[model samples]
Target chain A: MTKLTHRRLSPHILNRLIEGAPDESLALTDDHRRSLTARFRAVASNDHRRLDAWMVERAGLPYEPFRWSPASARRVVGNAALRRSLSEPTLTRGDAVALEVSDQLLRATSGYARPGSLASWLAQSSPSVVGLVSAEAANWATQLDEAAQELERPWSVAPSDAYYDVARARTTLRGRRDLIVPRGLTRVVLRVRAGAPGKSAGPGLRADLTIDALAEPTGLAASRVIGLWPEAGVVLSVDGTMEDLRAGARDLVRTAVAWQRHRLARAA
Target chain B: MTSLLDTTPVSVMDVLRGERDARPIANTTAASGLRAELEDGIFALLGPARRDAPLAIRASTLRSGTYAEDLTASLLAQVRGLLVTQALRLLSVGLEIDHAFDDALLAWRADVGSNELTRFVDQLESDERARLATDVTAHCVTLKRSLGPLSSRWLPRTSLRAYQRLAGGDVVLRDVIDLMVGTTTSDQASVALLDVTTSPLGEGAERVMRYHALVQTLRTSIVPLRTSMFSTAAGELWSANVDDELLSRAVGDVLETLRVMTVAP
Candidate 1:
């Protein structure tokens, strides 16, 4: 048998070699796209189901319900006002926008304690989390108020925070949908960013879109995903094709695997 | 306009609310002409820079100013929030919303990601944090005292960002307004723009205000009612009725700067 020699090139060298290559030459065929999507869907469904079963039935890992803040300090706050705008009548003034979010936040967090004393409760829950929700809420209110001046009203429906449970499992997924708008005969998931526009779909956002797509209610899946950067006044849209769904599924599986490993590692 | 630097802190709210007199922009044709001429020259100079680096004049680049400006601008947002939302507490069980700077600071920190200001705060020790908070508190107090309790009627710290394509889309002119009041109209000037700064009133102050007013005029085609400068550090306020003179001078100054920056050897 002839000995085989394999060369491992540095990533920098590999990237340099591929730099400025014709995109058409590197494009995937339709069959390749379909096959990749099918493989990803199988991994999410079949492989995920098998592993989850083993963790529960064989290893006897205790079920922990996933809990997520409806208004995390990160990206969620920017969406608060957009979500509110979709549900309420058009708000033309910043003050009105601020008032709207303040009411919604009060109602949303009413379950925690009372409306005005949320900081104390948040402090009790976690001191680091204080004022995070409020700041984001305020920023979103101001942003949407400005945006409303430019955007035409109508065409959006059923904007809300969503919670989904995996099929026959204790695991839960929480996500924010700024708006669900009809695209031709199908629906599209919309997210609005406050600052400059971004075209690249990062892994985290792709996972988020994937999870939201999978959690569609009653045979309805988002046919497209849109990200609107209002400051830059740019809209980025991606078709909800199988290829996109598979990309999302792939990210979701990677996340699930990492989460399981973290849980098991902590347990041991 | 008479100087009001007397026993009382000057009230910018009245000007923002359009209680003060405003003169129509003088020589609108001349001012507009100068602006166009200078902008074309600037784009011509910036063309080489664009070829070298396409993104040298983006929105973020437009905001690249002194560190003090960025920090003070952020701090002003918090102060504005407190003033506007003083009446209704989002999660307040009590009638009064919490006025602690510490809470507001924490919230601002949470929402802002890793930026220059955040990195600065991250490296600060407790003493440094306290010192920075104290200085911010002083500025806020002075701003509140100067502006008086802003009626929930007015919007505070309103942000404006727009891009005007110039040089046949080869060059983009980015405009940013710090805070604005009054509803803008297309046919006429209705809005009042207030430029907030941490630095004391300086030579560049009036020029900056003119630039801001000019940008708004271009954006809306209606002259801004008035342009004002509010310095939180010195507790001073200056207002000028937007006219063709200030706008023309601003255009000249911008053209000079561009000529020096890009065209000069």
Candidate 2:
């Protein structure tokens, strides 16, 4: 004759009962039965409200949501392929240049300030490629935060306790050494549906393509830049010298544009 | 069709009608039931007897009676009469001698019990019965002469010593007949009775035969059941080879699962 409440029969208790009880023993005592009836009514009411909320959200949806167009799809694909090649076990100077170009692209479109709950869900569900995507996203977000801080204080770039070592290096070994100076890296932010069709780069993709370029001791003083290209199929950071950098940048552009072409072909 | 005085004596007729002061038998129905029960018991004890033997006929005759002792005695006499009758009948049946012999034997056995006067007269003891013995011997000789041509091939083989032994009348013919019939029929019936008794253990002939056939058919059917899974393209992708042990284990698992599922709540 003990009274039972819905609160007492929590989800844990319910799960245990479902797992342990025989199929025929589903009957509940009078008080527990009454509580279940009331709980079901509350759930039904909440479901109705949730449906209405969804309808309102859909009504207020934007018409043109994407900032980046599919015009750069092929470029993104080429940059991604080059980046993969550079990160291989066997690395040459040429591979290093490609890596630098990839790194530059990765830094440029860095959007690390974004929330992580959605990405974490993707990581859990699609375990294969999530780790790399997450790393790229975090790097981009950090770069963006640093860029914002740099803009706030311009004098911070001068040789103080923070910039003195870098400055001394530049002056002491002036033209004798190929002193590599690490430039600001770009971060590319992209939103992708995991396990998408065809190439990795797609339209509606976003990422901070950071171009972290190392300054060579050449008269031109061109920084080694790498771009993070987060496209439909892959998140890539392309890096190289000025000449190689141009090639990597063009590759990213090609991937983004080809997305539309691929889409059209599929539709046809 | 002939008058009783011409065909058979007046005394024989009197004896047949029970007018000679013989005691009427008691509890004939109960006695018959007992005889049947005894026959059943005997058959339950022993197995089947050899065919065409005196033991088998004697057993059959004993099975047909109310009075056990009389039934036994009559059975022995009938068997002997059958042999004699068959020998006589064979002459006329010629080339179909075996068939004619068997038919004569059957007819003689059937009539043996009803011809009580002839049996009684044969059993009589009279030292001054020289005239009666001569008459009986004359009748026997006439019968033998009529049967001679039929038995000509085999009579030479039968010894006078065997005939004398049969006529000595010292053996309790009734007891001998009872034992022979009882042992032979009992032997035949024992096999069937044992089968019925052990039937609950599923060891009976019928059950054993059925199980044997079922096992063979099941063996054949299982091969096709396993092979059919590989006929489709999708099926080929998932094809797994099943050995006898694995198949048996799978079947056992399913049976165990069903047993658990069906347990009373």
Candidate 3:
């Protein structure tokens, strides 16, 4: 009798499992990480299609390119606020941090050469519309400030958003780390979300950590990933491992598939 | 207080737009008297209640806290934010299509907190969530239909909040303007304020616009040119040129509200 190998679960499939079992905590053991990594590698090798090709061809998705600044503002704002607060040791109150973050965002707008430069956009546009953008920025900064207050450790490296590009896959990933404080040999990646952890939050954090992990060179992985929902005064922590990357890759595939299905439905 | 000059009053929008037609307010005496009356009424309540603590009031609290009223306000604000952001993107970079209602909503939820609206939905059972989602979807459609065309021309500065103290900081009045357009000046009205509401047009809605104008007037010596209120539910707009009379009327209403609040409490 011929030996049979079971089909490896895709990121989407794993995500469904994660979503179904919300009560199950995601504490991946080292052995589990290795097994997951092997499964991820096997799946990637067997699947000859590149991400870009799958997105464009299989999904039939038109490349609706978006500016990075607005989509990634939540992550960027938190990190920037923390960096500014840390720079000025006297600044303690979240409100003060909130104001600083607001200023940073407003200042950064001047350098925005992107198609949707908020400053330039507001300058020509009606003054009333500027309020929406400013209010949005203010709210985000406030939340970040609250998150910053909750974070006890002093950050060694200044917080910033990062971009990772893989030439072979033609994939670009953006990672926003609220604070990156080094503890011994491992760097902790903290993410500040607005409210309490929802159903998708666990997988979402894993996906975020995966991007951060892949963005770094091999062997220098993030030791821990912490998701902070400041409004709820809650902290969710997960180990950063190769399993996260595998899960993230599966999520990417799932996202493409969902996009394809949506496109096809619309076309029909 | 500056005395009224015997001159023709300009429309508030024109002053805000910085048009040459901008002029001083028409009836400063009546306006001042009305304001004084309101202040007296407020002090009547505040003076006896608690001398040690300053009264704190939010502009939102002035309105009825009915579910419908709260829901409408929140919905209008959300729609305004969504439209403004889309308009910014369209004007600056130009997208092939602005985000659909669902996409815009997702973006809105991301930017805003898990607010009352989210909480309202979350507390509901599965069946209730389905029904509420359907109702909300329909409401969203109506709002989009009303707001889509208006979004491009608005070019507003949204969520402008201000506080004013009367009677030596014992009485504090707060107001938040949903949207402000054009420029503001000390000598001439140079800005137009737009207050968006989800509720149908009513006296309360009008008073809210007046409160916003009053706040702006206190902040900038020159009264704003036009104060307009838009109702998303009815898709109707009512705009009045800002004069001392309008600001004074708003002051009176606020005072009356305070009188009721402080005394009733």
Candidate 4:
């Protein structure tokens, strides 16, 4: 199964999360993808709905998409701004940078692409909504930038949250990776959590890495899946080995199965 | 009679940061020793840990009836606190927002989602909403003035939570700091904390602020530079610099609080 070689992540030392990451990468193989697809197809039902970690955890919840609020608005704005800051090495972190990133996002998505998304949300949002989004987003971005200070300069923000569809599996697996760093031939994937990481955080981190890998077009897998909960000043780093991939694959299959069972039971 | 504005112009940031001429020195204390004392006190109160029967004592629970047992008032307080919190998420970011009540109301409604509070608010009459609006407006005006400009350099993080388990996990002390500014990266003990309340800074305000400082100290193993409270009701600020004496007083307050609860009639 998946294992954490080093269990200790010192919160006492500031910016210890990215500074103490593992330096190993998993080589991509066609066999891995084929195995994952086969395993998913074996138990996959005709649910056809997107089965993300969130839906898998709370299958009973009938709806996932709710009306946009300050909380969700902040996430949308924060994710985009953080993505920009990480990608461009020279970009400094501040209000001016965040606002510039936000405006760039609005202009870039002015076309048919990302219509009815963050751009539209900001365009039509009231001054209060916009103001709150900007403020909250700035806080999250600043916190993340501070936490990743010691990390190497050439950091690449994951373009966007990704998803994978196994052919004939009839369901999709979604993963939202925040930042990615190149570790030689392999990569280091990171997810910045909003608050403190609790008991379920470990498994969630592995599952997220699995989903992101599955969604990635590149054949290469990450060296590790790093989880950062900045508020508590803590980091959880789990190694991405072959067993890690297998564990993530099995977890995704189990989620599909559980969702299938839950939906079927509800129908009955 | 002369108006207050004629005499002086004061901002919340000014008071919180201390005098314009003199910046308050960062104070440090033995966080481990103080935490041990608080944990030992809890152990004395509730001996022998029962893992199944763990107790969660909130900062509010330390106070008397105002924050206890009464469901309606507690629920009302929760709603009010959440609204102000949402408003701060805006104000703390340097948003030049107008109509504080309306802004916070929308924020509260949007952030709260569909819950009992949402239903309760939805069921309120026009006149009730008007009254809430008036009260919230007054509070937001004061809060907006006092919170001042947060920006990014201060590294403002809001709604930060701390959970400290004592007595072998039998007693849990939980607290949420409304806004935490400054940085812990430096060695000068440069962390400053603020607890915001929509209610007046009444008798229990200091107790709440102390509990927050205590939990933060135990959780981070770093003493805060300053711990303060601001009341939207009175537009007033109260502060206690972090030092040995303040922490010692906080530890005693917590122990006495637990004793009263353990020996309840």
Candidate 5:
């Protein structure tokens, strides 16, 4: 019995095993391949089964182990039969290629798969077993090997400038804005001086002025009807001198303002 | 005693805003009386000081028309605003403390896992684990409930305007009490040590310490004064010529008493 060379299976078959394929049909013809491609396109758009069948048929190889259903193909591709047929040199070379493809897939998908698993499966077969793998596959494998080596190099000596440029390109999409509110209450102060210094001694001598009037003048002069509350009431004692009294009134106004501001700020 | 004209008016706004420091000014009977009068005017005019105040001052006119009416309304409005603000402030404090205690209690229960003890007993045919779980769960529930009403009853019920006008406006004395009682950090070490020797009591001994801290903080914040005063009780109390310093002092005294009781060694 002729030993089936593992190299007979194409890279298209490897791609089919990794990417997955559609249902198997009995009739192995161009029309059958077309129908399978249509069915796979309905599901995933990229028909791995159609590609694999075309490669195998064009290479004029009998579909023996490769003709199984897609799920069974996944199992067989990873089996020991394929692993023994490939020489160590061929397996190692195939692994180098598979490693590149896996690395590319990972970079594209953001660390979604293990590199070792893909490399192990690809190393089980040779290019000759897979029959004339595409030039695109060979080129991708070489580029992937270079990328893997670049990644494996020491971070300290690695091309950090290139990485930084890539990172900068990613983050240049957007920025942010900030808003600030002013603090505390708005305030105004008024200083009052008695017209006649001694006239300060009498009760109800001057009427109470509204706060706004205190700030600015109005048409009507101050009214006795609006007499200050303290002026209307009788006093009990005279402990301090007139100057002291003026100073005390000033302090009280100051205290009121301070207290008002503190209260307002606390609320805010 | 002298009339308002006898005493010179100094603006309190500068002092309050920290623009000017308070001086040791003498308070003669006349000056004190004048000061009191000025305070009333200041309070009444607080609203007009706002940027969009309608009480426009005319440079030529000595009197502003409708100033008196506007001033009265403004004063009432200011008092109402103060009441509502204070009530909300107290409520917020109470809610925060209550939530903290609730969280601590939940953490304590989960840490012990007395709930799983019952399941262990059921599987083993021995009643020991079941009994322990039941006992621990009961103790935890008791401690949790001791924290008191999570929701405060002291929030203002009346309109904000009315609350400001009412004497002893919507301030709830109990809200302060709740805050003091709730925020107090119990002597955790002492409680744990005691629990080692004996089963933890429904109210751990450390609760008293927490109560003390709360009352002390509350008392320190309020200033004391000597006469009858108007204050927000729950936020609606407003009155003319009310002694605010006296009211603050009274609240302080009440908190002090509670602190003394809680801290009694």
Candidate 6:
């Protein structure tokens, strides 16, 4: 950790995570990853047929990959904008952050989002509309990230979002980490959400921890996962532990099973 | 670009930021305390808000929306205000406003997301649309004149949303700040909110400002340094520091708004 001369009793969330959070990786060994992987695979294998059926249907149908346009996709673009704002200068300048995010959306969604998609709306929209889209997308992240702008650098590094392909299953369990702070080999992941976090937030954090941990081949999972609901003004942080990973795996499997069963039943 | 008001000794922003002489500004802790109080007060008097149909409170819901009951003029005023706000955001972000109305309209439609609202807006007759466009351009000019080019140091954020579910999901308070400047550091409170409007300042306008302050406090624990509302139509700006008295008024306003919603059929 980069040491500061003096730290307050209760610093802001950024300071707490960067300066005070423990290294969760310290507790994990190769043995833990192997066990966690095996545990998930064992359960997932039981419902392989159902899982494959769901994956097949998922790819067969058309769907829009969520991305920001000038005016839509607040969460998707907001997180990215926040990370970019943390490192870049002059972001607070007229619509700079939003405009950059707009360009990013166009690049990310090209040939992916359907032609009539909102992500494609910016290309045909007027200058003011484009400005509006950029502003809306950048505003939430700016509000959250700018609050801690004075903190030292590298705290708001772009989070490495992961997609863990389920072992022996056709589905990818996606995990989102908004911001990450490094502490030696171990790291802490922060997720900035839009509104009041609900009861599902706990299971959501567990799932995030499990997916992020397993995505890495050799590295340990982040020491902590923080869920921030900017609208609600709340932060929830969960330590990465074996027990937490176990719960995360179980919830992921249970949720997949229930969802697959519902989808198959609907198709029938 | 220099502001139209640059000729004046003190600009509008200077006036808004001028009240720093007050000691002990509002911080996130006080805001948190108010949240708990507001939540407790709701359950104590009004009972819990029903999960199925909670009051989604907005600024327009104030004064029982008596003036906005399908009045075409009021609707035009609302749209005009939105366009002007959009114009300011666009200009702030470095977009040229050659056709202010059309540019803002495109962004506004995308943000609105309601098919009904967009459909109504898109279906306007050519003459009405032209007139509306002219009015919006004029308002945008006023906004540009008043706000000027805000320096990046202030960390200007546009259309900042304030949404919080209070009373354990019974009452949902939502508002939008046209422009927000400054933010809290680890030590001090520095956030300020500006609500841009088409109408002149009145009792209703002040109520909306108080409402914005309260919702913003709950949304971001950092109490704002000051909250101001500028009427693009009148070129008038009303600003006040966030203090215990203002927050107290906000809490009362929220409970009272919820109470009215609870009793209404």
**Best-matching candidate per DockQ:** 6
**Candidate 1 C-alpha lDDT tens digits along A1-268:** 1111111111122122122112221122445434434543443332333222113212324355433331443244445444555456464333343454355446546564453343233434322233335434444554444433433323442345455455433344444456564544455555555444322334334444545654554423465555544444444444455555556545444545555666667769
lDDT of 6 by residue, A1-268 (tens): 1111121112265566555666546344567655645654554333333222112223223234444455445555666666665566646533446555566557645756556655555565666666666666656666556534534636664555666665456456777776776767887776666656666677677677777777777647777777666656666766677677666666666666556555566569
- Highest lDDT model number: 4
Each prediction's Cα lDDT score?
A: 0.47, 0.23, 0.49, 0.67, 0.23, 0.66
Q: How many residue pairs clash in model 4?
A: 0
TM-score of each: 0.56, 0.13, 0.41, 0.84, 0.15, 0.79
Model 3, span A95-189: residue lDDT tens? 33345444654654666534455434334433223323333443455444433443345554334554555434434545556667565556676
- Pitting candidate 2 against candidate 6, the one with the higher lDDT is 6
From the highest lDDT down, the ranking of the candidates is 4, 6, 3, 1, 2, 5
Ranking by DockQ: 6, 4, 1, 3, 5, 2
Please give the clash total of every predicted structure, in order.
9, 97, 22, 0, 46, 6
lDDT of 3 at B163: 59
Q: Which candidate has the top score in TM-score?
A: 4
Report the C-alpha displacement of residue B45, candidate 6, in angstroms: 1.9
lDDT of 2 by residue, A175-196 (tens): 1110122233311111112121
What TM-score results for chain B in every one of the models?
Answer: 0.70, 0.19, 0.65, 0.87, 0.18, 0.86
Q: Where is model 4 more than 4 Å wrong at Cα?
A: A4-24, A55-63, A83-116, A150-156, A195-198, A215-218, A231-234, B3-7, B19-39, B51-53, B63-78, B147-152, B163-170, B218-221, B263-265
Q: Comparing 1 and 6 by TM-score, which wins?
A: 6
Per-residue alpha-carbon lDDT of candidate 2 for residues B1-265, written as tens digits (9 for 90 to 100): 8755556322211221222233222111222232233344334333344323222111122222222332444433443433433233222223233333233333333223236544554565664234443433333333333222321111111100000001111110110100000010111111000000100122122222222111211211211111101101011111122234433433233223223322424
Candidate 6 lDDT at B257 equals 69
Fnat per model, in the order given?
0.09, 0.00, 0.01, 0.32, 0.00, 0.63
**Model 5 lDDT, full chain set:** 0.23
Interface RMSD of each: 12.2, 55.4, 17.5, 3.4, 39.7, 3.5
> Which wins on DockQ, candidate 1 or candidate 3?
1
Q: For model 1, name the residue pairs that clash.
A: A115-B91, A115-B92, A116-B91, A116-B92, A116-B93, A117-B91, A117-B92, A117-B93, B26-B244
- Residue ranges of candidate 2 with Cα displaced over 4 Å: A1-116, A119-222, A225-240, B1-265
What does DockQ give for each predicted structure? 0.08, 0.00, 0.03, 0.39, 0.00, 0.44
Tell me the lDDT of candidate 3: 0.49
Chain A vs. true chain A, TM-score per model, equals: 0.52, 0.20, 0.59, 0.80, 0.14, 0.71
CAPRI quality of model 2: incorrect
Structure candidate 6, residue pairs in collision: A70-A133, A71-A133, A94-B92, A94-B93, A95-B93, B28-B221
lDDT at position B127, candidate 4? 94
- For candidate 4, the C-alpha RMSD (Å) to the true structure equals 3.9
